[model samples]
Target: MADVHKVVFYPVGNGDTTQIVLSGGRRVLFDFCHRERAEDTDTPEIDLKSRFKDELKAVDRDYFDVVAFTHADLDHIQGSTDFFELQHAKKYQGEGRIKIRELWVPAAMLLEEADKDHQQEEFVLLRQEARHRLLEGKDILVFSKPKALADWLEPRLNERGEAASARDHLFIDAGTIVPGFSLASDGVEFFCHSPFIKHCDEGDIIRNRASLVFNVRFLADGAYYDYLEVGDATWEEMEDIVRTTRYHKNDDRLAWDLYNIPHHCSYLVLNEEGQKGDKETEPKPLVKELLLQGKRDAYIVSCSKPIPDIKESYEQVQPPHIQARNTYERYLKEVGGRKFLVTMEEPNANKPEPIVFEIASGGVTWKRSASIGAPAIITSTPPRAG
Candidate 1:
């Protein structure tokens, strides 16, 4: 029998929220978007209150060992304050508290050095807690900062003698691996794959470029487990990692069993000419090449809405807007073996409830289990050995 590793991708609509349960039972959660605030009704499936509350109850809030926030984007961090406060409040209210063993976040997201908005009160409070209170004894791992890039840019600024901007603090240094827990061992072997020192620029570009990309690898029972999670990162960020770093040189770093499509499968990451409108073009050959190189078996897209159809109007008429649906369809066709899983097809469909992936007995299987229905199981066939 194969040992088991379990992952639950909670429905968060257009934002990323996934829970990884290791073989040894340790649980790690990545990113959280508030499901309660879906009233604007931009997408059809948003039941903010139900989804958010149900997710918390489904996990019993007791399963989280590590909670990670990819960046400071509201969609990513909306639940942090709430989660923390809820746990604390529950403790005070005589309800059992969810114990978060540790908190992992990008240093740029938590530290003063990375703050571009001087007036952000939440940022200030988080920094204060992280630096003074949390660092005192609590477990907090800050991903690497871009010291080399910062140093490189520092000299240019001095030479110009213009006011040094707060943007300099946003650079993420390369090679810093966030601490991770595993089911098979004491912890999972994980490493950052992007936002290397060379990629850090300024502003949103820096945020998107400096986004932390990492891979988790472990052995559960006799089966090998591997997955990649790249937070809302773009192609420019990816190209830099491939060209400037040692990432591609190491097979372990680039390979994956499952991959989270970056930027929700948006084509903005692939071309300088942003999202192409609703028209479908042949898939970008470069994207195909990258996917082929990784040889992933499962590709997950965590988007809130149905990816815009190739024939639909472009979501954004602005320059640089790439049609997400066209990109997704083309990529799926190019990567023939891998199954593409999207979370937004049925906001209220019962056939596929919370998407569940499990590794057990030397293999993995996907199942859909909803609160109101029976579980639909799909056993995964291992990829043919090369």
Candidate 2:
């Protein structure tokens, strides 16, 4: 426990949920989607609420430092309103449930068209909470928007003459460094890289491209480690991101020590037509450069269902695509110093262990859970009331 700075990927089936515990006990959550029940028999059924609380317990705290909703997809923000404190009420504060100190969201989440994309009441409530925070200028950080947010803040902010002041802390645009932020006391800098204004225009309904991708750079021992979290980005967006970062002379921004594969290893992220197992469908040149052109100790984490051999699972070739996994595996082996880890494949019994990576000056190492199967569901807190 040498001041462990770690990132944990929860095994919530073919969805995304990652927790980063920084050096100083500051916790940042990427997304959250827990299954009421696992769709596949092999997948484990776990209590998401309890699992999240355990992470809170690790820091001897009762809340997350920041909870980032990469996008409003059901698999990403589905159970948030229920799991975290959504209101500033006594009842919501003392249930052993954690509070979110800040909510990081892409501007796309505020769009009315995206509401249909997340018809769940949980999402509606989350939006309400975010709106509440934005109005109060409290626990909300709006990325990539001002006019739209200003419209929401009209009458008050427009009259106060303080709107210009809020822009320093409340608003962040793509390619911009986060204002006065870090992971604990670590020299970690998070750079916002997605939800470009074009993607959130009034009529844009494609939510995947609105993902809040960030390039996280931090100093460990003496070197810098870069972690890229791109939630469900399509190849089209990936192409733009790589090209834009390169053109800006931000090549270091694209270099990664760890990369969470986009869209859960979907073949579409690699190319247009799906590449089957062992098939040599050449990946888009830009994508090859993005993944292959990384630190020698680079890692690729697949947050999805266990990958099956291409021939065995070709009939329903969706995400966790065997061909995609094969492509990554090939790269790792060829590099001879890289790793490709999958959540479900972590060793354990009765359930999959969360895949945790501990970072230090030397490099990073996998930290396995202490016990197998999901922690027992908490009985003290009453069931969430909608």
- Best model per TM-score: 2
Superposed by TM-score, candidate 1 places the C-alpha of residue 338 at a distance from the truth, in angstroms, of: 3.7
Q: How close is every model to the real structure, measured as TM-score? A: 0.73, 0.86
Tell me how far the alpha carbon of residue 162 in candidate 2 is from the true structure, in angstroms, after superposition: 5.4
The local lDDT score (0 to 100) that residue 319 gets in candidate 2 is 72
What is the lDDT of every predicted structure here? 0.54, 0.72
User: Residue 296 in candidate 1 has what lDDT?
Assistant: 38
Residue 342, model 2: lDDT of 78
Clashes of each: 19, 1
Residue pairs in clash, model 2: 221-361
Model 1 per-residue lDDT tens digits across residues 84-196: 53322233222333445666666555433544666445445444444432223345655665454345434555665644443333223455444344333543666666655
The window of 10 residues in a row where model 1 has the poorest summed lDDT is: 85-94
Model 1 segments more than 4 A misplaced: 38-63, 85-97, 112-124, 147-173, 176-187, 198-205, 244-248, 275-288, 294-296, 308-310, 313-322, 346-352, 371-376, 379-386
